[model samples]
Target: MKTALRTTTKTGTFAQALEDFKQITKVGLAVSVVFSSVAGYFLGAETIDYKVLLLLMIGGYFMVGASNAYNQIIERDLDALMKRTMNRPVPSGRMSVNTAFIIATVCAVLGIVILYMVNPKTAMFGAISIFLYTSVYTPLKTKTPLSVFVGAFPGAIPFMLGWVAATNTFGIEPGTLFMIQFFWQFPHFWAIGWLLYDDYKKAGYYMLPTGKKDSATALQVIMYTIWMIIVSVFPVTGLTGRLHLSVTGAVIVALLGVGMLYFAIRLYHEKDNAAARKLMLASVAYITFVQIVYVADKFIGGY
Candidate 1:
């Protein structure tokens, strides 16, 4: 009985920790940071500094966690109203605002310090990402539908942030990565916005252009999906200079873009919740696979 009880208690604790971590930051942001840094390492001449990369990952996680915590604190009321977010630690009162604030502040400070150790430019960008996310984007969600576009700026930074951290300089390679991600965010996020439009409205958040689900929103998603494909393949054309890809690499990249395009088109035509959900999942896979391909191609003497 005692052994069983202990096992049950451990399971519960693990669940709680997962919930708290999601509330504090998010898995998406953490993964993005790691991927971007890896991509950046490749961009910075395919050199890796394990120590610096470790520091940057730690700092990135902390900063992202801090931003999420602050967002929850500010949106606690709205969060409670949205079915999707109602059970979050803050809205559910599983954690208090005061405690969350202290945790966030400490994390932000530590993140900045670590990033500074990596490079001043990286540190500055990290600070800027946090500032824009917490200070500007969070509040704007309730005020306007355009907030999604505004939020994309910070959302797209992690990939490029890695390049700057790796090279301690901003140049064409990082810029290319930045542009790819920047364009990618729209279709990716719009798919999510479609899936959660109703949930968002209940909380007074306008995540879609029309603040309603319709063809216009879906069309916009399709357009951006097309743009994302175009940008993702740009490196192959030599327009990205040092980031140029070889024919084989370009073909692989084009295949990934086609995968993304397939989902986007499915979502556009179906205009159903299930299709949108699938598209969102596909978008996640698309980004992860493309980043992996990019890093591998760079290292393996691929184009």
Candidate 2:
């Protein structure tokens, strides 16, 4: 009986530790960022270097993981105030600040080192991303509505990072990618803000543009969605040099944009959490679908 109890306790402890790590690192969100980075690499690389790709994937995840850890540390108190985040590792007392700091430091060092193995530019950008996310975005959450704009800087970098890692230069092609992501974040993030407005208010986070759920905010969401769609279609114009989008690719992106716009419009009309939730879901689908199409077009349409 004693042996069985001990085994069960150990198993439970291990499982909880795994869960704590996931929550601390935000595994799902990190995976999406890495996926975006990989897509950028594929789009830019003349020939895929599998070794460099491996390093990018591993290094990118650790860098992202470090950013998330640091963000939690900064928001540990705010997180405890919000219902959704109150149960997270640091806020919940499942992880110590010191432990998280150690994890972030290790991840940052190793991530930068691994990225440096690829090239100096890659490493430099990786470090900049961590710094911007932790130092700028995390604190700005409570100060002003402009935090979203500031956050977009680091948020938009992964796509461009992938291109830079592959090509080792920041040019028009990667710039186009950066612009697409930069604008996409407005609606994507605002919709989340809309859905969680009350909860975020608990933590004094002004994630929305207006801090109020009203027409002005909704109009801004719609406008940004339009801009994001416009930028997404620009690559098909051949003006972006290496980042060409064929005819079919253009149509697919337009369709995806329309889908997101539809939700944004609904959110405008309703101005409620239900509409906000739909928009949020649509925004995720739009970004993921558009990214996949962008890469797929490179292969099937061949510029």
Using TM-score as the measure, the top candidate is 2
Model 2 stretches astray by more than 4 angstroms: none
Q: TM-scores, in order shown? A: 0.92, 0.98
TM-score between candidate 2 and the true structure: 0.98
lDDT (tens digit, per residue) of candidate 1 on 232-261: 888887777667666777789789888888
lDDT of 2 by residue, 141-242 (tens): 999999999999989988888998999998999999899999999999999999999999999998989899999999999999999999999987789989
Local distance difference test scores for all models: 0.82, 0.92
Residue 220 of model 2: what lDDT? 100
lDDT of 1: 0.82
